[model samples]
Target: MAGVDPDDCCRGAHAAAQRGEFTQATVWDACRTGIRDAIESQLDDEQASPVIIDGLPTIGKTQHATDIAFGLDVPAAILTHRYETRDEHLNLAAEHQKTVAEIPTLDRDCPTRRGDHGSGWAERINDYRSRGASPTYLHYYLQDALPCMQDGDCPYLARWDAVEGADVVIGGPAHAALDRVVDDRVVIFDEDPGTAFRTEFDANQLSTAISTFLRRNDDLPVDNHFGLIGAATNESMDAIRDAIRDELSDNISIASPREAVDDDDGHAEAPTAVLAMLELGGPIIGDTAPAEYDWDDQLREEAGLDYVELPDGSQVVYDHAESRIIIRRPPDLTDSRAVVGLDGTPVEELWRGRLGVDDIESWRILCDDCRARYLRDVIGYTFVQTTSHVKPYSSGEYVNRRADFGLIEAVENRHETAPGVITTKSAAERLFEESPSEPFIDIQRVTNRIADVKHYGALRSSNDFTGTEVGIVLGSPHPGDRPLQITAALEGYTAVRDDEGKGTDLDYGIPDRPFLRHYREHKIAQAVLRFGRTTAATVYIHTGVLPEWLAEMVTAGPETVMIDERSEGQRGVIRALLDEAPGTAAEIAKRERVSIGEKQTRDWLKRLRSEGYVSRDDSQPYTWAADGLADAPHTARVRLPDLE
Candidate 1:
């Protein structure tokens, strides 16, 4: 027996050993031996049994096959499903530094006439025969003739006969020629071990292919020379096994497949353990032990591990052992710990303080398998939705409403485009000139928010007064439900408008005034509140209505209560006092010398506070202040009467 590199052949065998499949270990060992023997044999005799190998994605199957082919000093031809154009083939050939011939399928070329002939009685009949060529027959013919074709004879002619004579054929799953090739050639199926057997071919085509290959070659000398290796996903091995049994009777193999190693005996080797670990989720900081960490106990406990427990009490589980890692929980200790490799090298660590409690809990539940698969697949593109009227302004309001509905976290309004009802480019120009800085908000600066708006329209002319209305619209990187809070904001705007137009002749104009301003203000407030809670970021409110006096009140100190738009100075002063210090109406009445008038003030303040502008903090004196104003910068400090 030839000496097999421990790193090259031990992974799958180790997994088999864990499953207690002793026979599988032998087979795995034999497969490696066969590869080495085949290489040496090829050196001694120009023709040797073709080496066949198979496995799931990332399970080292291709690596092993490549190594074997390289060892034998023979060229390898990889047939893939993605092979399309001659350019693609040429590119792959250049990449692998090997010649590639694609199997032609039913497409535009198969039924087309090669040469133009005058359509006539005789030529028509000849054309019909030429155009009626079968794809399968052409495929077969090409496979047999292409390799020997001279340079100018037709580039598509590189056929399967060439594959048969080649040193190695690294084939992907394609049924037509593979079934026939299995008879005289060494064949390998590079499948994703995690769910390779679950492929459509296994469910439908594998049985027929295997049976046909077996039946066709029955008469040939029973040479241990022909090898069959099925690469299984470490994650979905059970599925693969079931697929195999579904295809053939259980009695075909030497014995039921077994684990290639003994867990208690640490001598099993690292590559096997590494494969098992990769299947679970590649090594993780604080979750997986360094290779140097004595793994005797771990190996024993996870003898057939569906999950692995690290020293810190966090557990890493395997979902699709062949493809993903799912981190279930990190160690209990908050010490910044990470996953380390066998060489005690740190891979990655969970971000401390960056994640919320819910996110932390979620991270813990992730198993090794998902992590491995997802780490490389994380999305790189950042997407933002844009529409005509639905640009940044209305979109910001929609985002705020979404945040209220817990659909998003924050919304920052950047700019506003004039309502689409304005006619003429000149009118738009005028509106923009009046509010030049209010075009569209740059979406890049905002985080965790949705963008949505009311509607889009094109103006007829500058003087056209009929303001056409439209419904609300939304856009985002990913789709989500429309927020109900936005509807409430719209309703609030409508209520305020109806109240304002209580006795006006131009009440109809009320609908045309664009309810966006009301919506924008409310959304800004909401965004500020959410920002404070989620990211601990400051919220700056820049508005024309935000009085300089009120700015001073908030800026001087963290004042929770803000009262503005008051009609009478007395009422405003009394209300502001009571807001700064909440108490019974009777106590306020005594202080203000107003006979139960303080009750009315108290009632108004209570209503305003309930509307989300102000809130009461738990203090001995029971202080009240603006809720969303927590992070508002102190642009101006207003002197208020010391109510205490």
Candidate 2:
């Protein structure tokens, strides 16, 4: 779009028409003006306010973003995860495209399919040599600029000559970091975690005498006391933690911010000293970490201070995003230009808080029911398998070296089969080399039936299977992994347990032995929100183990293949209780329909009683009763002293 005009969208519509884009007669949906006005007001300000487009994922947020660029008659640089997202960038990027030769870079290797490798690779090599820099050398020497750099006109920063003229700039955080962005250019961060940056510290640096002692001794370590804090007591957690420690110790500072948070916070639900040493690059420097994240909470856990020593077997969780909010808003990447954030999660408060800008304009645009509709399109299983979190017990004596942990399978396998299964990385590892299960085989058949679409990767993670009929997540990765489930973490997806008896929000126990409990609840739901991105998702729970995490069909949306929880012979007992009269434990045991002896009857009755199907009398001779049961039996195992 060229030549701004008084009529808000006049020039934009014209340009889009000329370009044969944004042709929708009613391109702007219900919230168009709210967003349009926000952008315009920002532009009018001597200093533009960063806009946050907030709503559920897969709604028209992206469309609205594109419309804003068009409505304002400004060129846009769109940043997105997939190639298909290119269309979202304002028509400006298309105008900015340059042949490979046009991109100024120290890299002279003009890789081409049309080439003689010897001559092709060599010609570019010489071009790089002539520039007084090797292809490997960053021309502007921008490799070392901080997030708050003030260096001007570094060829390395603006080397993408195209970006200089580009109306808007789009790309990942790396693109956002480049000095190419100018005061006039508007920047948009499409996802959360926005554009903050962190550097890494060495994990080994965090090691101390206390941590080393805890490693070999039997004092029963405190939550965050040693380097092993948050690790499963078992060999699995210990092994992974040690390996991570090694990886951290070996770091030579590979360049650039990683896809996930590389520092402390990314290692698990929150930052630990080890992860802080390995991943958190700063000092967190001058920028305050997100307020939602409680730094002190983590500290208290590390010191085992401020915690009550509880009775044994109580659950204790150090602070995490769930119990309390830790604010992670980083300092502004730029002070001079406009920056906008687009998000699908319904968290205006969270995003605005993260932006930490007093004047950031946040609006909640209505989301469509497109997500629910997608749910109706698929059906699948949500397997609930249990794994052990065992660590060798260590007293003053020798340690038991045995560690048993069983979890799900690889990223690809969990994704490839099923109407879209949700599993953990650990679970995926279990199935990594195995063939699809019987149900999984059927899922594959269904997926394969779609000739033009595949339901493998993105479909399973979301309620909106926009491009395919189904979506499956290769199970959500454990928080301990480096990818940093940002969407999940942002939605307060941090796991919680009550076993530690502490007042903390996070479990400093072994990280992944849960391969189940911690993962299933938050992982699936978040996968649905971020869908392809792993924010939230869930499958029906079919287990005798944990039914609380199970959900009704259409977990993500309306579509579902819900299999009821397996009865496992509990139904017969339930049926027997339908209208039975109060009876002695022995009488109940002899009922022909019960089909079980006294021992079996006791177990079944206990199960039924706990679930509310049966009630036991507390009188003289206690008896069990349900709908058909008569008044309480005179047979209590012992009469409660008749209360006066």
**How many residue pairs clash in model 2?**
82
| Candidate 2 per-residue lDDT over residues 334-371, each given as its tens digit | 54346667654424434443444555655544322322
**lDDT (0 to 1) per candidate:** 0.28, 0.36
Least accurate stretch of 10 residues (summed lDDT) in model 1?
Answer: 338-347
Please give the lDDT score at residue 530 for candidate 1. 23
Which has the greatest lDDT?
2
- For candidate 1, lDDT tens digit of each residue in 397-439? 2222211111111112111211111112232233222332311
Candidate 2 scores a C-alpha RMSD against the true structure in Å of 18.6
TM-score of each: 0.23, 0.42
User: 511, model 1: CA deviation in Å?
Assistant: 65
Off by over 4 Å in 2: 1-28, 44-49, 73-77, 81-84, 87-137, 140-159, 193-196, 202-298, 302-337, 346-361, 367-429, 435-465, 471-644
Off by over 4 Å in 1: 1-79, 84-100, 108-134, 138-165, 168-172, 176-180, 192-644
